[model samples]
Every structure is written in structure tokens, then in C-alpha cells.
Target: MPEFTRRDIARGVALLGTMATLGDGSPLFAEALDAKTKAALALVNPELLSIARKEAAWRNGPPLTKNYLNIRKQIDGSVAPPLPDIPFAKHSIPVGKGIPDVIIYVINAGGTKRPAILHTHGGGFVLGSARSEIRPKQEMAKALDCTIVTVDYALAPEATYRVSVEQNYAALKWLYDHAATLGVDRKRIAVMGESAGGGHAALLAIVARDRGEVPVMFQCLIYPMLDDRTGSTRMPPPGIGVIGWDVPANVFGWRSFLGQQPGTATVPVTAVPARTKSLAGLPPAFIGVGSIDLFVDEDITYAKRLIDDAVATELHIVPGAFHGFDGAGADTSIAKQFTHAKMNALRRAFGEQSV
Candidate 1:
């Protein structure tokens, strides 16, 4: 665990204070959203809104000020508590060439050969870890009676573009290769991720198709950060950037992951799922995003492409929600609906009769 200084603690306290002031379902703040979006924002989750407010404050400054390490520590601290006390086993898989071994969190699912999910944590690609964001995975494991493996893929600046993708791919392959030992059903494996993890999950599906080794039955992308062009070459819809992962933070995350300025000519298609010309032959997908989220346009666009390619896809756009709302309002009615929809999609993809 990383050590937090007084300043870090104060910043976190200030964030809580700011969130407290926002109150639950503030009508004043709801006006920033569009009419269609406002309906969903009627009962805004204060906890999620707080995260948006913090991001908004960060957006007001130089994006680089939000260091990956610091943000990771703070987010981990916030989520570490309230996480379900689910039993999870950790394992390390070797991915040669001196790169760090991939760390996987295998949640307890009793002693059965059940469907498995290879989860990729969000954080724009530079932040997040399996340990920091284990709640959702825990919930999914218990709800669906499945084993969940969340990957701690290498972060960016240090591990650029292909490294994280290949590492996650390797994790998928390892999970498949050792299915019996891990108590996983090889044919029922799926790739799931949130935010940057969603982008990685999308990439992993592409990689799986290309490699023709491990088969991914489905992909559950929760408001994926798919396009590098987003927040750079592409400007989001009007008023959408008012809260939750504004452009400045988006630019910084992309720059850090790409190891160069984002939206540049040199970025490889392999690194950006949006840059990929084809969405054919990929697995079925479930994509959920909020209308106010910066990634809404890109997520909708990607879902359209998948549909056009004749893939089975489900796209859920929450009216007034923002990025990370599902986590922020996990206990709220809307958040429960969001989660239920996602779990239902996964259950169907896994060929289960009931959710």
C-alpha cells in the first residue's frame, strides 16, 4: 500500500466536503444537462456526483497535475472500504521478456466449473488496479455464481500501448489454458472492463479473433474509453463535458497511455479500438454509458459499428448519469438498474438460463 501524506488526506476530505455540499439530486446542477439527460439526473447519486466534481476541479487546472500514482492511491483508498468481503485468490502468470508478471484476482466461487470473466480495471489506462476496484467483480461473482479474474495490467508511460494489451491477452490465454485448475469453463469465458479497461477488453476481443486461440464468448464494456481521438481530434457533444471525466483529464490519460500526444498520426490501430477498421467476427458486446459522460458519443458510435457488422450488441445510455456512476451509486435505484442490466447481459452471454 502507498503512504498518504497530510495533503493527500486533506484533498480527499475536501472532495467529500464538496460532495456533501452538492446534496442528493441538486436541481441547480441538473440544469447543466440536456432535457433528455435531466430525466435520469432527477435523483443524482451524490457519491458519484462528488467524483465528477473532483474531476471537474482537476479539469480546471493542468491535467498533468493529477498524477497517476496519487489518483490511484486516493481512488483505492475510497473503494477499499465498503467492498464486499468476498474471498479472492491472487495468482501471478509469467509474461516473458522481463516485463512484470501479470497479477490476477480470482474471486471465490465455491468448487464448481463455472463461467469466468477476465476483468480489466478502469483508470484511463494509466491508473487503477485489481485491488482498488474489486467491488463490482465481487458482486458479479456472487450474483452470477461465476469466477471472476480481474487483471492488474501494467500501467502507461512505463508500459505503453501494446504492452498492456498483450499482457491482458496473455492473462486471457493463461486463464483458458489452465481452466480446469482454476475451475473455469473454457468455453464460457468472457472479457469485461470499465472505462479504459473497456477499451482494453475491446482490444482483447480483437486480439483473440486474430490469434485464433482463446475464444471470448462476450464483451461487457461499461462506458468504454474507446477512442484516442476523443477529447483530442473529436469534440464531445455540447454540455456533455460539464461533469465526469472532462476533456483535459481525457487528454492527459490518453497522452500517458500512448507515450506521446494523443490523436497523432503515429498511433497504431492496435492501440486504439476505434482506429480498427473492422468490427467483424468479434464477440457479442454490451456497452453502457451515460449521456453526460465524455465517452458517450464514442461508445454509441462503436456500438453502431458493431451492429452494422451484424454482431449481437446491447447499448444502454443512462440519461443523466456520468462516468463511474454505477460505482458511485451502487446502492441507488438507478445504479442498481444499471448493474442489473449489465449482469443480465453477461448472464445471457454466458448461456445461463437465469440471472
Candidate 2:
């Protein structure tokens, strides 16, 4: 079997469609799919289906192994989008002895006390960088007129859960301590991220709550990869996780990040957000996911758990969509609506009038 490169997976995910073809270009489960599964596939949004058909078939790459280091290097070395025209500054803050300083980018900072966001970038906890997301963060900062701080947290396998979490917490603590200087209203700061970054954001909120130091006003989780058991011990319905970030990828990402097999009993509750028992006293949250995405069930369950614990939570489920649909199909109406809902949620959380 040919080993899959990170670029190959990235290209497949960029298409954001169903895995309708196998590695050898054969039909995917054409003869074996149950009626219920066919019905689910038919319900996929027409716009997304059109895009899905235009790409080469997606294959479940081999489990990430020794070659994962190569994958990480490829992702880190990928070309980043040009910096936005908006003004921003970068800083490297000391995390601890013998650890690299956490780098952060500040945008729309300074003036009077204004709402703020501490953003984390997603790469399944193993890949990605804050620099890659600068363009979108700059646009968000401009649109919302709030200070945005994006962190370059350490990735997993190389750093592990504890290191990354503490690094993020350090960034949060730095933002809170310097809010006045940055013209940010410390009390109105929110935490936000997409995919694994969303998981980190959720973890940061919980850590903030437990540490009794920094206060997080809101958490925005975009299709967060929260539960390690989603593709391991607990499986999704037939039509889910068949495209974009699928079962094999999920298992690899989780295993790499946790430094152990996913769905095991020994995983720490603090490391995986879904495993955390209490949601009380955590900030209000906005959780959004596509109905067919691998994480839909886990995200929804987390939202329900939060509401059950008396936390104010808003859960938005998009129909006929897959993971990363918003980015892959940005021009589609569904993606537009999803983005609008997210911005509106942030506006509400920041005490600004909705657009």
C-alpha cells in the first residue's frame, strides 16, 4: 500500500465531500450500503455533492506512525496566506524554564477597554500554526472591533496534552494580566477555535474555571474534535465520518496527541474535554457542527451536558453538511449562513449589537 502524505490528506479534505470512491477508483459500498445509509447520503446538500463529485476519491490513509514527523513538517512548512492589511504585532512570552516561549499575535489592540478573543488554531492537535490563521483573525478583529490574540500553542506527540494546555493557559493569563494595557476589557474576553483548536479552546475555558485566575466570558467551538472515543470505542452512524476527517484520521490524531490509544479507560478527564465530569461555572458556550460531520454527536452531547449543568449554551446544527464545509464551500449559501451565525454569536457574547 502507498503511504499517504499530509498533502494528499489535505487535498482530500479540501474537497469536503463524501468518500464515494475507493483508493482504486472503485465505488464505495455501492452494493453493501443499507437503505438507511443511502438515504443519509442522498440528504447531503446539493452544493456540497457537486463539489464532492469533482474531486478524486478519498482514501483512509494508513495509521500515522513514524512518518507522522514528516507529516508535521510538511504541514508546518506549507505556504501561509499573505498577511492581512490590518495592523498587528507579535510577541514571544516566556512560558517556563526549559520550555520555548509561547508566541502570540495581537490585532485590533489598544484604545479603550474593548471586548477581546483568545484564539487557537486547529490541526488535530498535531499540525497547524497561528500564523496560518492571521488573515481570518485580522478580518474578524476588524469586523467585530475587538482585540484578538492568536496563540502558537505547541503541537502534540512532540509536546503532549499537558504542555500545550499549559502554554495556552500562559497565553490566556498574559492576555488577562495585560488587558488594561492592550485596551481590552478583561471581563469580556472570549475563547474561540475550530476543530482541534476548538478542543483546545474548550480545554482553556475549563482550565481557567478550575485555576480561579483568569475568567473566560464565552467559548466558541467550531466543529470541535472533543471525544477520543468518537471513532474508536464509539462509532458514528453509517453515513457519518466518511469524508474529510474520518475514523482512521481521528484515531491517529487522538493517539498522537494523547500519546496513547484512543477510547481507553486510562485517559485523563482534563485532557479530553468530553471526559471532564463537571461543566458548572464554565463560561457560556457556542457549539456548532455539521449534522454529518464526525464530531456532530460529540459536540451536541457536550452542549447538552453544559446546559444540564446550568451553563448558557447555544448549539447550531447545520443540515446536509460535512466537516470543514464552511471553508471548503465558502461560496455556498449554507457556509455563508454558518459563518453569519458564528459572528452573531460572538457579537452577542461581546455585548455588541448583532449585525
Candidate 3:
């Protein structure tokens, strides 16, 4: 039920009837489905979307803002290097025969086989690298003084969907099989990813659980790209012309990664975690997404579903912000609120809530 009033339904029928992807998806989807989710949503909410355009005005500041706000490159300068007077060793492990480009950054967290975080970076599964996550992972290492193995998995338009997910599974499997060598506890290992990587984390968590090998302590999914359907009313509202990410890019990302247009008959949950049914006996979870973000509704709905399935789940929806808001470097109060909330969520799940 979409809270759709009769008036909304009439309006939606008019809007969706004439909906077009011309003002939408490209470069990725050559195929079109006769779906108009955006139209239906507008009718249901009857609210206008206001995107702050003036924020992009030429600042003449440093070429890049120093706030460490690139979600792919978001980092704080005060972040110290790999925890307590201990030295961390870096290594490359096998993740699908050198396909995922998996790399590891390790440091002594100064405790018995400590809890570890298998961190994955997000770039719509096309643009981020393990290097981009270093600053945050370093900051996290300092915060909890725990072992973290940052993954550099393959991207889309090249490797596509399922490849990244399979790589994620491989990395986790290796960690579980050799937890002692990695200096982490197998039972306490958790999966963490942002955006597309977050989707990958969620999907891989399901994969690992189904395989019945490694047990995940928790999953930190930050504004994860979970859904596979492209044209549903779940897209960014039309009036909000925020670039960087939108319907076109989403379709392209899916086509490139899945090797087919999204919403196709063969699309799999391994490629889109939102399509999955079974959500039980996996792990405690922390999920966060901004209200206007493309994934907001899906994220909130997924959180509710997890709770419905008797899973321990904590979800926060940061209103007044859109997708990747925390990394956008906007001075809006909402961005900071979400950033702090996200950090707090990570801290709580990692057993470092005091920080």
C-alpha cells in the first residue's frame, strides 16, 4: 500500500501514462520497460523536490574540499595511521584468481584474535578502489584498534554484477579459513561496505550464510545500492536535478555490471540484494541512508523487513539529504547529522560506541 489517495491514483495514472526514459536512463539501458514508479510516487506524496544547486558555486578553495567528504574519498585529516604503537602489514590474498584485485591492510590491534571488519569501498561498483577507503579504514583502525582487511574488488562495465559479489564471498571465505594468520577472530568477523559495495556486502552475507561456513557478527550497509529494478517509482524525483548520480547512471551501472538491462527476467539477488527473500540467521545489522537518496525507501523497507524476520537491525534515515549526502561536502545541517550518525552506527557495531 503506497498511501495513495484516490486523487493520487488519478494523478499517477495521468503521469505514468506519459512517462518517458528520454529524460532518464542512457549509455546502459537500450531496453525500455513500461514502468513509471516516479510518477506514481509523485502522485502519492504530491510533494516537490528541492535540490540545492547553488552549493556548486566556484569556491576558489583547494581543488578538492579538505573536509574528507568524498564518500569514495571521505576522510578526516586528524585520522591517525593504523592504531597503537603497533605496525600493520599489507598483503594480497587470492580472491577468484586475481580477478577481484583483493588487497589487505593489517595491523596489530593489540589483543587476542581481535574482531575484524572486512571493509568494502563504494563507487556504484564502477569507480572506487581500496586506496580510496584507506583514510576511513585507517581512522576506523585507530578508533577500535581492530584488524580490518579492506577489499579492492572488480568494478562494472568491465567485470559487471555477480563478479564483485563472488569476489566479496571469496575474500570473506579466505578470512574465515585463515583467521589466525590474519590475526582476527573468525566468529567475530563482520562485513562492511558503502553504496554499491554495501549491496555487495549484503549479497555476500547472504551467500556466506547459505553456504554455512563462516558466521558474520554484523553487517554495516551504508546507503547500499540494493535494488535491481530501474524504472520503478523508486527513482530520484524529477524536479530534483542533482547530477553525479541519477537514473541514467543507475541503468548504465546495472547494464555494465549485470551484462543486461536491469529489471530483466534473469536478474539475480546476487546482483541486487533487494530481490532476496530469506533474511534470517545472518547477522546483526546497521543500515543508514539519506531520505532523498535514491536508496532511501528501499533501505528503510529492507530494515523493516529484517526486523519483521526477527533479525537485530538498526536503521536511520537522514532526512533533508539525498544519496551520498555525507560525502557531498555540503554545509547543510542534515549532512553533518547523517555523518555523525553513520560514524556512531559503525562505532556501535564495532564495539567502540564510546568514541
Q: Quote the lDDT for 199 in model 1.
A: 92
Q: Give the top-scoring candidate (lDDT).
A: 2
lDDT string, candidate 1, 274-351, tens digits = 989999999999999987778999999999999999989999998777777666445567778898899999889888
Determine which window of 10 residues in candidate 1 has minimal summed lDDT: 14-23
Clashing pairs in 1: none
Which wins on TM-score, candidate 1 or candidate 2? Answer: 2
Compute the lDDT for candidate 2: 0.79
What's the residue-level lDDT of 245 in candidate 1?
Answer: 61
List the global CA lDDT of all models.
0.74, 0.79, 0.59
RMSD of each: 6.6, 4.9, 11.5
lDDT of 3 by residue, 1-355 (tens): 0122233212211101111112221111213212342332232211122222212111111222121122222222212243445455566777655465556655453467778888777766655666545655766666666777777777666687656776777778877787877667777888888777788888878888888888888898988877867443345555231322446556655676788778777886666777787787778888987555567667887888889888899898765454554554334466566667766766676666644
TM-score of each: 0.83, 0.86, 0.72
lDDT ranking from best to worst? 2, 1, 3
lDDT of 3 at 44: 23
Q: In model 2, what lDDT does residue 321 have?
A: 82
TM-score between model 2 and native:
0.86
Between which residue pairs do clashes occur in model 2?
none
Candidate 2's residue-wise lDDT over 1-355, tens digit each? 1233334334333223223333453333333444544555676788787543232133333334433455454444543454556778899998885677899988888879989999998777776778766777888888888999999998877887878888888899999999999999999999999889999999999999999999899999999989999989999988786646677768877887898899999988888999998999999999999988889999999999999999999999998887777776677899899999999999999988888
Off by over 4 Å in 2: 1-41, 54-56, 60-80
